[model samples]
Target chain A: MPDTAPPAPSGLAGPPVNLRNPVLAGVLAFLIPGLGHWYQGRRFKAVLYAVCILGCFFGGLSIGHGQVVYFHWQNPENRTYAYLCQFWTGLPALPALWQAKYRDPAVFEDNRLDRELNAVLTATLRGVEGELRGSIQIPPGNPGFGRGFSAPFEGQLRTPSGSVPVKGQLSALMLDPQVGAGSRRRIRGYFDGAPTSDNSGPLVGPIEGSVPRPLWDWYGAPLADTDGSPNSQLNQAHRALGSRFELGVVYTMIAGLLNVLAIFDALYGPAYGDEEVGPLGPTPGPNPTPGSPPSPGTAPATSTPVSPGGSA
Target chain B: MFPATLLFPLLAAPVWAWAGPTRTWYAIPLIISISLVYSASRHEGPPLILRRALRLMLTIGGFMLALLLLLLLLSRGT
Candidate 1:
């Protein structure tokens, strides 16, 4: 050990490194795993830390179809506690915070059309409305809930009693999409078809249908309806992944948490009293490995108590 | 630029198609990561970190397997 230990902010790594700035390394690591180590000239540690942390983070994202990391702190039903851990992954998870603040995801599953029906003047159809034995065809266009074709329709309307041939005109108007609680837009139209009477319209009651919500409204947004809101994206996320949603959350969370250790490693040298391997390595004492044998004196410098701050 | 979700609306669906029953296997990467990071915290050199990480990985994997076996034995035929 040199009888003198010169100190500067950048020379914090003792067993002595020239420019291993610890504070900057910590901040960089917090922003992106391994960045601090990279800044500290620990290239190998940097690569491994980045690989491990980012792999887990992105892997969880892929598992959940990129729906896992979202921040909703104020919403009682959507308070994302896992985000406390997920936040440590740094930049990748930061977007969730932006989304929570700026994006609304203002759409929900309502009378959205499962499929588009083309305009038809008189089309044959079978199994009309499940119980109806005959087919029904209405006008061509995307119909919302409670709305059907304004044009004439021809099909057998099946009843519990028996199959009955029915002919009528379907008329309905689109309802204004007033989102529930001002949070989500529900698109729907109501229509009651005229049955039997060509001039009068449907014999049956009204039906409601809707156009599907845009995908952008739900992706990466918090979806769980834990707040008793029926219009959450959680339903869709749950439908797609089933139980894997939680697993994805766990994976990303662990990755975030793991980066914390890397941050600490960057701020302070090895947690155990292991000497940093470098040209100015001090004599092995103070903290010795339990099983490893001490090295013979190829060379040894005078000893001084090591501080994490590299203070002598 | 438009978000990818808007471009590929259907991407909401899970694309990996991992087997539903075998999610337990997904822990391998997590365990390895945990081992590597934890070991790195305790050692300064890359060689020391790698060697320590390998032992930690084995230890964690063994513990999980033993726990799984215990649960399997306890829950048999239930």
Candidate 2:
């Protein structure tokens, strides 16, 4: 008679593995916008990766927009919150996104030939050239040191330099967040000619600040100084967005990555099993024919059998 | 521009002979607030005497206050 001793169960070598419910790979990802894909074993898209790539590329922009508005209203200053808003605003506002993405400080260049040229061109259009002069009075308790002012046109008041005409009233300012007051200050000396405190009001002095020499000097001042040419002031606001573009691109890319990861997770992660191989592995099937009696040389199944002895 | 109130005609003339930025801003909000209150009162048809008078008073009062605030802003701004 052939020996019929049951083969030893290979507990360590269980059936081939395969996962289901791929969506649950990363619970946080689904819970959090782009985290589930990351949980399902995808990297790079743990945070921003999902938002930029997946959200933007996959018609998720509407979702991104709503999310952005919700988050922006919730936390206006947070970079993450700001990006959430910006991402919805889309590519035209890329510069804004770049800043929010990286939290970088924008530094305006010392010269803005483009703005100067534009102003010059526009002023010439209205017959007599228009000039704007203003001084800011920053209170002592404000964040920076002494306040400064901007000269009208800064010598570029004669020619058009850019595509857009320069309208002085609309020119932007490089506002110091710490100062609740004006950024520019006019030197209003005492009746004795001794410099007293700068007055807090609109442009009051002669248009002499339009000369190039003073304009150049004003622009040359440090980024924080209130003393700047009109071009510099506008450029400062632009720079604030300019320096941030690269950073925003990075963050958007990260969001995209997370979005992709989430997609992948939703498509592939497992539903059940601990210490089990990911769903991508091979799965096992019955031995071709069901209910066939075990052969004399057949091995017992590796999985522990459910005991009939547990409380009924 | 429609029916000029006592203060409206004076406020509108300097900048446009019809309006000022500060005054306009104030007027818009006040008008909106009046319309809102009128709707909120849940009346079926036109407002009665007391309601109509109250609406006009709120409209005028709110507009004046908003104008005052706007003037203050302009005085202190560029």
Candidate 3:
């Protein structure tokens, strides 16, 4: 062989390996967005990745008011696909898993109220108009009952004069689970146990013996009963971000998804010119030129050299 | 001690408080971040990265705007 023999051809060859452990770099990036690039000694790129990915993630948290990022599988209706993309951003974004595990304290609180209000209002409305009319009844000694009704009462119920009954039905319907949090909370005051002392009379207690135990359970349970209020710090931070909650969610998800690309870069360096290796190694060669082979008795130039620099 | 009543206003404020009619504007920062990060990944040089990022951002924004216009026209036609 000549003094300058060509290097051995290895299948796993490309750009110079920059990191002590590319796998570690990829893992670091997966865990902390830009950490892999930082591990690879690409400080500027690392900082850029961190800022872009984290900025988007936290911005989304702020926009969505922290309520936007959560994972749930139990309720098909509540399953948020955004978390799928947001999870890629790594650690700072992991609170969503915690939020999901804890059942979103804010959402749980809202759901508790929903279950309560749904039961009570369903019973009340059914008493007034539905098939349960003349059937639903509240029990004596119930906290909700006024002292006067010791006996099981029944028949068409009436609210205090000048207070409309239909309005309560409308308000109750707004608390139904299908409604969004914003719209549901808007009507919370109307049915939140306070005397609707305005146009909707004091909620006439359900008919004695007619109201279901489920409805009363809602009225009696304490506020802290549902999963205790969400992480206060998270709640506070998200609240501060205010109306941009959905936007914050998008930023965070994009950040996470972007980190996925960063992880790939860490594992496989920058994709410069490794295109020669086809799915099945280097492609055959350029097509034969117009008339014939370059030499009268030799084969056409079908297989070109694979690597850029030819052998010495 | 801070009176709990003061906390009510802060806590009770709606999720959509500041986001009300102009929520769409939030896309600007997100797009800029995406452009910067993506371009930075391709080039090690800062100046070239930023220049390419800006170009990508403009291209993306223009495409989005065109899509929006097309959607608006379609809706009006319906």
Candidate 4:
């Protein structure tokens, strides 16, 4: 390529000036908010952008307990629109892609398991109660007390005659036949029909529709598997945060959208004209000629101030 | 000095503490941030930017409040 450098100034000269490369600055800004401004030596603006934008983003992450950031395209119904704004925060938002790809499928699978468990629990309780009332004497040591059963069963049951072999893995306590409660009420309470004094002992009480751990894991928790059950450290953090999850998501999304402005500023100096004179100084006010003294008494030609935020 | 365990939980505290009826206050900081950034991008001098940002914040806050009130009335069908 030919050396196409412009000829040196022919007259008295001033200090040498450095020009900003908009493309490089814009790319840097996109990679990290405010980096482009820092590249252009706008240190103040760079710091401002970095602090405000990143603070909002990280603040949101802490609020959501890291659950608000995932993306889900496979199941469009599950996709959170907040991510659309969050994607503008550049690299910080990329983990959402990893979360969507690896984590969401497992959550969906757990949801399926929860639905199946719910059905089995409901059916098993219905069958047991119906058969017990209908005079079907389950043999003394039958595997399912003479009822054909498929689901895994655990826990003991006591009847009027003797200990009935009541087997079901859903509840952690034995069903007391002498409690004289309706079968529907027992099923609602998941067979923890009566309160036992020993807290360390099995949870045999009329809990207010408390679903099993696996079912609660599916219906209530967003990051149930990663948190390792409801009582795990991560879930405890989530419970503590409560309803502020939405606020966290908003903070992150606002941070990302704000970065879009920084990116634009880096690409094309400020939306308004630069404060300092540059190689291509503020678009030559109304008069085109450079260095020409204004003619006597004509008002100085003023440059048009750009609109708020230099939106264009 | 705070305990080490307290520090982490404090840092990780949700945006709003005891966020019941006062939950609406959470939007104030966000609106201020939005105003500051928007106004800063449009002006050069620090004084000018700060002044514009404050004005913008008030304008946006008032608009949101008006909208909220309008919605509340509409919801009541009054």
Candidate 5:
């Protein structure tokens, strides 16, 4: 009797808001990173969708991490790892394609926003691949965790036949993100009196800032030589300098972990039409061109039909 | 240009390999930088920041390689 039929359901009711068919939404998401939500009138998810895919890639460049070095090697294991890393690390370039498919109907058919998004996504993917192949051979010491100047640097050079004891100071420029910006320090050796220096050219000895701590500083005693060559020690040092091999393994693992987080962000994060919850959609801004159709080109506003609960 | 960039490294590779890893390690980064610049610059529609970055990396890497090469050559000549 009290007109309980919802006042005739004004405005266009979207295909019955099927909250049950997650597969439909998932497929939609798979197709165009943010469409399933956009289809459901969720806007913010769309933005997050674009950024995570694009941002990680840009971030990869800043740290010099995404180098691609797969060369179809003969070793099956090596080839398999190469393929794994490529797919594992290079999978962020698919969402925009998803968005391109379910572009907001209100926006102009040739959506400019979609075009820009595509450009950035493509650039980031290629950039990451280029970065992965390019390796930055750091001298020694762990960078980022703490100052690297303190790490032990020890290796024996190799000769044509045997090896010789080689000694050289391993030093790194402490990328201090504090006072004395761009400062560098050097650790001469791990013995009793290891000479140290900081930014201001050369100091007397043993830099005052953060005492150098040696992690694995060791020297192998000279062994018998057969063909005897000075270059041998250096070669042996090169071979022994596989300390960073573990570091590489660690880095690869970290990259893989980040890839997982990125994937999750791509899936359930805020998308278009996210802000329009609560009593009414975002304090109705001065509706720029109220009567005019919402930008026929821009993806539907990221915030549309407020969240289902009272708090939109 | 890339072929030239790569040629020098390839030419010097055996020499560096025979010489030692310190030299080779330095040389590899240089070669990589050169290849990256050559490759990144070739990508169409990149922003200025990206273009400059590629060139900057190339310059740093090339300079390092050249310096190392020069040092090696000098060491060899000496």
Candidate 6:
């Protein structure tokens, strides 16, 4: 594309356009879609980029319940590559980085009352599986929360063959599967709900239940599975969003990518540089062999350029 | 329905709130934004950008529908 075009047709210069600072304009456009264009007295591109890019970015977040964009560089297990594209959205997607940094695994809620029967017991549980019935008895006021809760539980631990009645004092504490400023926690630790069940000794297993997930922990967070496996995290996220996950990811990535074009436009006029291409695009050159360059008669962007003060 | 939400989340109230309808409906806004932005990048005149963007949008929508139909036909008996 030629840098300069023929002089603009008379009476074309409407307002002053200042694209003198290419580096600054590029950087500013990168920081916020259309900002550099606005600074350069290009309101049309400014509003266009701001509306399209910001709309796409936030729209994606809402679709995925704000889980589509995050930053997780450490622990190669669950590194979030989507963040690279999302970073181009600027401030709207920046909080995830800060939230990820200060995330404390030790912080957890102590309310697991969903599974406790009227049997008056401590430590409620979520995600009650089949045949695992009966009340769990623990110390008053959610026992061993952050440091891991352990207590004896009495219930029928479901086995492959049948329900085995086993009751014993559980040693390891089991918290909910949700952490980070929540009322419950992730399902960790083991509990012997029963002992000597189907002719075996002590029924030991992970606490079972669906703990209510927290907003912060789920929003734009690279949450891993309880076993510290990265493989299932993405699956879990996809399950949560249903088929909308891919759409949300694409929307956000496209938003960032569109801003890249806006940034270039700000750094150096419009991409076509004052060409006279019609809706069908530049005049067609001779139909040449597949990879041949365009003939000079129908060059793409060699038309008259709008002066610095010309309206775009 | 995500389809309704996709079109107008604040309105439309969803005829099937429980069952999110077709995901393909997202192509409407996606194509619109993409075409407009791409066209704006290539032209200084708003009228020119809108004209090019409309053409591009129609072309993309038609191409996508053709692809979808082809895929359905190819997998008809499967």
Deviation from native of the Cα of residue A11 in model 2, angstroms: 25
Q: Write the per-residue lDDT of candidate 6 for residues B1-78, one digit (tens) a residue.
A: 334224443222342243256676777777888998898776667777787787777668666766765776787789
Q: Pick the candidate with the highest DockQ.
A: 1
Tens-digit per-residue lDDT, A1-312, candidate 5: 131212111112111122223445445554444454455444443443334333433333222222221122333433324224323334342222222233343222111111111000000111111100011122322344333433232333233544333222333324221111011111121211111222222111222222211211101011112234544322333244444423333333333333433233233221111122223322322223223333111212322433333222
Here, model 1's chain A TM-score works out at 0.52
Query: Considering summed lDDT, which 10 consecutive residues are worst modelled in model 3 chain B?
Result: B7-16
Candidate 1: where are CA atoms >4 Å away?
A: A1-14, A17-19, A104-219, A224-231, A273-312, B1-21
lDDT of 2 at B63: 66
- Model 6: residues >4 Å from true position, as ranges? A1-17, A75-77, A101-219, A225-233, A278-312, B1-20
State, as a TM-score between 0 and 1, how close model 5 is to the true structure: 0.21
DockQ of each: 0.34, 0.01, 0.19, 0.19, 0.01, 0.32
Model 5 error, position A248 (Å)? 11
After superposition, candidate 4 runs with Cα above 4 Å error: A1-19, A102-243, A274-312, B1-21, B67-78
Among incorrect, acceptable, medium and high, the docking class of model 2 is: incorrect
> Which digits, one per residue and each the tens of the lDDT, describe model 2 over residues A1-312?
122322221111232222123435434443454444344333432333343334432222222221121111212232334344334322323433332233222222222221222222111222223432222222222112333223233222322332322222222222222211112221221110111233322322222222222322221122232334544432343354453333333334444343333343334321111122224431222332233232211122313232333211
The parts of candidate 5 lying over 4 Å away from their true place are: A1-21, A28-36, A69-74, A80-312, B1-78
- Candidate 1 residue A276 Cα shift, in angstroms, is 12
**lDDT tens digits by residue: candidate 1, A248-282:** 99999999999998887777555543444444453
lDDT of 4 by residue, A1-312 (tens): 122322211111111111166668777887788787787776766777787788788777766655566564544444567788988887777656554554444333311221223222322243232221111111122123322212233333434544343432233222211111111212222332221322332323222222223322221123323335776423554576777777887898899899888776665444443232234532322222354332211111122333333411
The Cα error of candidate 3 at residue A120, in Å, is 31
Better of 2 and 6 by TM-score: 6
Candidate 1 or 5, higher lDDT? Answer: 1
Model 2 RMSD, rounded to 1 decimal: 22.9
